[model samples]
Structure formats: structure tokens, C-alpha cells
Target: MGLLIIRLITFLNSQAPETTNYHIAMTMLANYSNLHLISIGKIAKLCNVSKSTISKFARQLGFDDYLDLKDNAAFIENRFNNPLNYLSNILTSIETDGFDNYLNAVTTDINFLRVNLDFDAVDNIAKAINDYDNVAAFGLVFSESAAIDMQYKLAYNGKFIRTFQDDVIQEDFLRNAGEDTLIIILTNSGDYLTKQQIKLGTPRKDIFSKTKAKIVVISSNPVVKNFSFVDEALIFPHQTKYQTHSIMYQIITDLIVSRYRYFNSLL
Candidate 1:
């Protein structure tokens, strides 16, 4: 899920279905394929509201203006190939290859991780979480779910961590972080470093450059190793066709937090 869509969906979920904000958000989602074509005037007319109403709706969703909202939408449009499309691909595979075959592929990925994952690097990350007073984990959509899971699991082990759902705030935190901060990027495909951009027009590389925090990128994408900004890159197994599912992130999070618990004598 792109951050823009996530915000829109969140807005829709919070508002009543008959509200103008809900109608506008539902319209934007339904016409997401042509989000660039959306304008305040058009949405206002469609929803039987004034242009000011649409602009207010945009601000309520955290955009400075309607144009800013559209710009973010365009950014998401370019960054993501639509995760739902990837889900459809998985569904097609299950239909064609059988559910048992799909499960076997998932098992193969789990087995590969169990065999190939570097326990030393896992311990190092866990140690960093213990050493640093401020730690934040970030990822997109499904990967973000893993970060939240990590936050919860670590809480039980007496390690409180932070996770951000909004990319704008996530970047703000990065830009202002101190040297004592430990930034963990939990990306399944590593697209955040290579392709993602902040709403302020800064690329991920630029944001990393501005941050003094130690950066660790845990990804299945091997290409992250080429990035100099990453202080440590824990590259996970990437041979599976189920990259869209992001199951590895949860597994890796469990491993890291479990190790953190072990180091604290709670395991």
C-alpha cells in the first residue's frame, strides 16, 4: 500500500460513509488509475460540494493543499506497481499451480531463510536495539505490519521501539534523529532505498544523508549492499517468487526480537 492510498483509506475508515470527505476519498480510490486527472473542481462537482470543501478535505487528510495531495498521489503512482496486482498474480498462481504447490513455495522460502539467515547479523541488530536509547523501524504496508509486530514483541521483552506508518513523519524523524538513534529499515523488496521519495521531493538517499543516525537496512533485495549510506545491510534470501507477500520480514523481526529477549535473559 502506498502511503497516499493508506492515508486516504484511513480517512475513509474514520468518516461516515455519507460524509463528503468519505465520498471524495472513495472517488479518488475508485479512480486511482487516473489519480493524476483528479482535481478539486472535478471532485467538488462530483460530490456536490464546493471547491473549498474539497480543499478542506485534502487538508484534513494531512496534505497542505489539494495539489499537494495530487502530487503525493503521483509519487505513489510511480513508486508502486500496485501491490494488489501482485496479490492477483499470487492468486493466479494458486489457481493454476494448486494451493499445495503455493504452500510448498512458501515453505521453500521459510526453509531458505532458516538455513541461510546470518545469526551473527541478527545478534548484532538485537545488540544495537539494546545499546541505542532511541530506535525506530520503518517499512511499507506489509513490511510496516512487521515493524508493528516487532514493536509489540520487543515491548514484552522490556525493549520499547518506535514504528511510523506515515512516510512524511517517518522522514521528519529521520532528518532530525541524533547520532544515538538507531534506524532500522524493514523492507522486503528494498524499494524504499532505491525508488521511494519523501513528499518534500527529497529522495531516500538525500534523507539518509541528512540523518546522523546509524542506518541498518534489512532487505531481501541484494542491491542494497551497493548503497554507501547504509551502515549495515542484512540481505535476506530473495530467490522466492513470493516477494509480494513479505513473509520474510515478519520471520526476521521475530528472530531479531527473540535474540533481543535472549540477550536480556528472557528467552
Candidate 2:
């Protein structure tokens, strides 16, 4: 789910049932498809509240204004409507393939990665971690989790890596980043540069352009290498739709840290 939907759900959970704000949030979620078109006056009428109350409710949910809320609602609408981005796509794959067959396919993909992964690139990234004092990793959803994993693991070796769950906060970090910092972007597919949206539900225009940090992308999509800001790209084999990059990312993180420690031991 996108940020707006998640915020609405959180609001619903914390609220008592059948209240004004609760009713408004519920209405917004129930009519998620047309949320962008639902004007503040209309929602206020539907929830039997004043327009000012609706505006306050929007702010309570962390939106700058009613229009900002609508923009984010539109983004949520587009994201859930797309079958390719839906979480249930994995469930459908599991049902069709059966559990055993799905496991076998994942095993095969793991073995393929084992045989095909570029050790030189992995070692180079490990070295980069040692060479740079400031490093950060970023991605969307599962990719974001991988970034957190990288940060946690690297800390054991006296290296600190930055990561953020909020797109706005991540953008703020990138805005001030300089050549002294290294950025590692983890993407299951190479589409993050094009598809990522900020808190305002708008494309991050010139976000990378503003940063002078050295960038390295680890992804299953080879096309990430073509991006002008990227200094290095580590491409892994793409697995089936049922499988996510979680396992592969963990393996990559472990290998990089192992190599980092090996090199550090020599000192």
C-alpha cells in the first residue's frame, strides 16, 4: 500500500468507530478509486462536518492541504489498480504453482545467482564501504528493507550506513549529499529511478542531479547501468514473480561484509 492508504488505515485503527474524522477516513478508503475527485466540500457534506474540519482532518493525517491529500490518494489509486504492483500477485503465483514447485523454482534461481554473481563487483563494493566514511542505501518497500539490512550489518564492522523509510526524509538526505558520500541503491527491478514518488505524490525532479555522491546500484535489472548518475551497477538474475529480492539481497549483504572483514583482518 502507498503512504496515504497506510496513513488512513493507521488513523482508522487508532480512532473509535462512528466519529466524524473516522467517518471521513472510512469514506476516503471505501471510495479510494475516486479519491482525487472528492472535493473537501463533498467529503465534509458526506461526513456531516464543516469544510474547516475536513481541512483540519487532512492536516491531522499529515497532508499539507486538501489538494495534497487528493494527490496522494491518486497515487494510491494508481498503485493498487495495477496488477503488476499488487501484493496478491505473489499469492496467485503460489496457488497456481503449488508450494513445492514454487520452492523448487526459488532454489533454482538461488543456485543461478550463486554461479552467476560477479565476485569482483561484490569485492569492489566491499572495498568502497571501507574507503568511504559516509554511505547510504535507499529503495522502495522490500528494497528499503534491504537497505536497512545493509546498514545493520555494516555497523558490526565499524561502518555506519544511512537509510530511511520515508521518501521525503531520504530525499532531504540526498539533497545535501556531496562527493564525500557514497550512495548504494537497491532495486529489485531498475524502475525505481522512474517510478519512485515523494511524499507530495510528485516525481522527484532533479533529485539525483542535486547530489554529487558516487552512486552504486544493485539490481536485477541490467538497464540500471545506463542511468547517468550511477557509477557502478551490480546486476543479479531476475527470479519469478513469486520470489522477491529479500533472500538475494541478504546473501549479497553477507558476502560484502564477509569480504570487508577479510580485507580488514589483514591490517
Query: Runs in model 1 with CA error above 4 Å?
Result: 1-3, 10-39, 45-50, 59-64, 67-85, 197-205
In terms of lDDT, the poorest run of 10 residues in model 2 is 196-205
Q: Global lDDT for candidate 1?
A: 0.77
| TM-score quality measure for candidate 2 | 0.76
CA lDDT of each prediction against the hidden true structure: 0.77, 0.79
Candidate 1 displacement at residue 34 in angstroms: 7.6
Residue-wise lDDT of candidate 2 within 1-267, one digit each (tens)? 677876787578668986888998898898888888988898788778899998998888878888888888875434534454535555676787788876877787788899999999898888887788899999877788789898899888887888876566677888899999999988876666666543543444577766899988899888878889888888887666645577889998899999988876776
Tens digit per residue, CA lDDT, model 1, 18-113: 876788888888877668677788867777889998888888777889888887675343344444334455777688878887778888888888
| Cα distance off (Å), candidate 1, residue 208 | 0.8
Count of backbone collisions in candidate 1? 0
Q: Which residue pairs in candidate 2 collide?
A: none
Off by over 4 Å in 2: 6-64, 74-88, 197-205, 239-241
